[model samples]
Target: MTEAPHNDPAEQTLRELESRVEALVQFCDRLQEENRLLRQENEQLRSERAVLSERGEQARIKVESMISRLRSMEQAS
Candidate 1:
């Protein structure tokens, strides 16, 4: 049987609506993936920052100790 061509206005409208909804769903999925990756990267960066901060503090303390030793030697001389 030959199928009739779809010429109904309501059917056309529904098809268009379905197309738009599908596009929106795909866009939302992409955004969610991007958000998840960004959060992971942010967490990694924060952890790196904490490690760097600790190293800096430790270096500062070592430098201060050396300065104190130098001052004592100078006073003895």
Candidate 2:
């Protein structure tokens, strides 16, 4: 196919395209940084939640044991 002529309009279009590409690159870089920080925060929160769940499970086991002991004592008395 034949190429289009490079007139004033083509030059203007190229400049606009360059400007848009630069803006998109900058935006993508910022978004990547933010996403990295969010992922780190998410990992940390997950770790904290895991620890809390373990503690809750321990507490539940302890409470159940205590309840069973109380029932046994009451039955004996």
Candidate 3:
């Protein structure tokens, strides 16, 4: 036969606390995983930004050189 459920106040409160703790532990684990993923993504973005910035600087230098050559030719003509 199935035993009757406990109606004790202290036991009920303890069970509730246990449930809350379990939920909190799960939530913390999820947050940690999410934080790890975000950090990885941030690092990748930083690397990409650095590469793009370098490329932009190179392009700017090339453009300036072209402009200087054009000015020189104009002045000679």
Tens-digit lDDT track for model 1 on 47-77?
Answer: 9999999999999999999999999999999
Q: Which model, 2 or 3, shows the larger TM-score?
A: 3
lDDT string for model 2 (1-77, tens) is 97667777988799899999999999999999999999999999999999999999999999999999999999999
Best by TM-score: 1
Judge candidate 3 against the unseen true structure and give its global Cα lDDT, from 0 to 1.
Answer: 0.97
* Per-residue lDDT of 66 in model 1: 100
Model 3 bad stretches (over 4 Å): 1-5
Model 3 quality (TM-score): 0.88
Candidate 1 wrong stretches, greater than 4 Å: 1-5
Q: After superposing candidate 2 on the true structure, give the runs of residues whose Cα lies further than 4 Å from its correct spot.
A: 1-7
Model 2 clash number: 0
Full ranking by TM-score: 1, 3, 2
Give per-residue lDDT, candidate 2, residue 5: 75
Better-scoring candidate (TM-score), 1 or 3: 1
Instruction: Choose 1 or 2, whichever is better by TM-score.
Output: 1
